[model samples]
Target: MTITTDKFNTEKAPKPVGLYPHARKVGNLLFLSGVGPRQAGTTKIPGVDLDEHGKIASYDIEAQCRSVFDNVRTILEASGASWMDLVDVTVFLTNMDDDFAIYNKVYAEYFADNQPCRTTVEINKLPTPIAIELKCIAALSE
Candidate 1:
């Protein structure tokens, strides 16, 4: 199988925290990193704040959720993939109950045509105060 990475210069996407690109394409699959709403080179999104050491942001759920997905879109474009190529997604939310509606609103935009299989769950924590993080598997060269 062949492998490649997708990178971009978008300020709207979060900077990688380690020795990794935002997404990597292997064979027909683009494996995406888990993403949050934090802007590139910053710890917080515009209207979000850290409540405690491990608490997630209690901001407008829709906006924050949308931001993370937007970052995903950029990464997909960089990988020569698109939302239409998504095959599966796994979402981790610190507040899934509170953010489900917002997630649905934004998720629908990308998943309208070929809805992928998905699973979401509320977790105890995520990186920074971002409410959610999403990891995806997408068709890369299809």
Candidate 2:
């Protein structure tokens, strides 16, 4: 059987900062590109404050977590799936020591009912000013 892959792009979520589509589906799975907390239709990073030089002065990880979850949900719904369909998630944080606790708390709240495999790691930075990003995969109805 020939497998087909389809790309997904939606207006309900932030337009990707790069050329990639928001998600892609192959066979029975939907793979999402890394989704950040930037608000849809704008570059505003929720709960983030930048200094006069435009560097990260402070940020709220809880806000970023909630926003990212919402963005992931939006992408999932737009791609014909839901939050519970997510099977795997990979999170990138710019500061693990400072942000993990808050991020974890918010993550628990969002995922209380749907427990998906998750791995979170710290990176030096993201492409934007956001504190976190998520890469996800979901099982789609066959």
Candidate 3:
């Protein structure tokens, strides 16, 4: 069998900050780029508290996690997939110690039944002030 790849873009989710599609489908595997809490066509990020100069003041991990998952769901649906199709997910957090519990709680609300394998890591920063981001992979329907 020959493997084919296709790129996906959707206005239903936040536009990619860099030059990349929201997802790329290679055969049955749909690989999604990192999704954050930013809204489409706006600088606003859910759960993020920004200073007057746009520095991160504080954040709500539950809100950020929910928004990130929502964005991921949009992209997945746009690519003809669903939450149940997700096979793996990688989570990024600016503060694991402060955020993991809330983030995990929010995550369970969405994926407890269709739980995908997940890996979460703490990072110093993200491109925006949001506390969370998610990159995922889904198995496309045959």
Which stretches of candidate 1 lie above 4 Å from their native place? Answer: 1-12, 51-57
**Selected candidate, larger TM-score, 1 vs 2:** 2
lDDT of each: 0.75, 0.94, 0.89
- Residue 16 Cα positional deviation in candidate 1, in Å, after optimal superposition: 1.5
* Residue range 1-142, candidate 3, lDDT tens digits: 8888999999989999899999999989999999998887788888778899999888777777888889999999998899999999999998888888888888889998898999999999888777888989999777
- For candidate 1, the clash count comes to 0
* Cα lDDT of model 2 by residue, 1-142, tens digit: 9999999999989999889999999999999999999899987899999999889999988988999999999999999999999999999999999999889999999999999999999999998888899999999788
**lDDT order of candidates, top first:** 2, 3, 1
The predicted structure with the larger lDDT, 2 or 3, is 2
Between candidates 1 and 2, the one scoring higher on lDDT is: 2
Measured against the true structure, the TM-scores of the candidates, in listed sequence, are 0.81, 0.97, 0.95
Query: Which residue pairs in candidate 2 have backbone atoms (N, alpha carbon, C) closer than 3 angstroms, thus clashing?
Result: none
lDDT of 3 at 111: 92
- Which candidate do you rate higher for TM-score, 2 or 3? 2
Worst 10 residues of 1 by lDDT: 3-12
> What ranges in model 3 sit over 4 Å off?
none
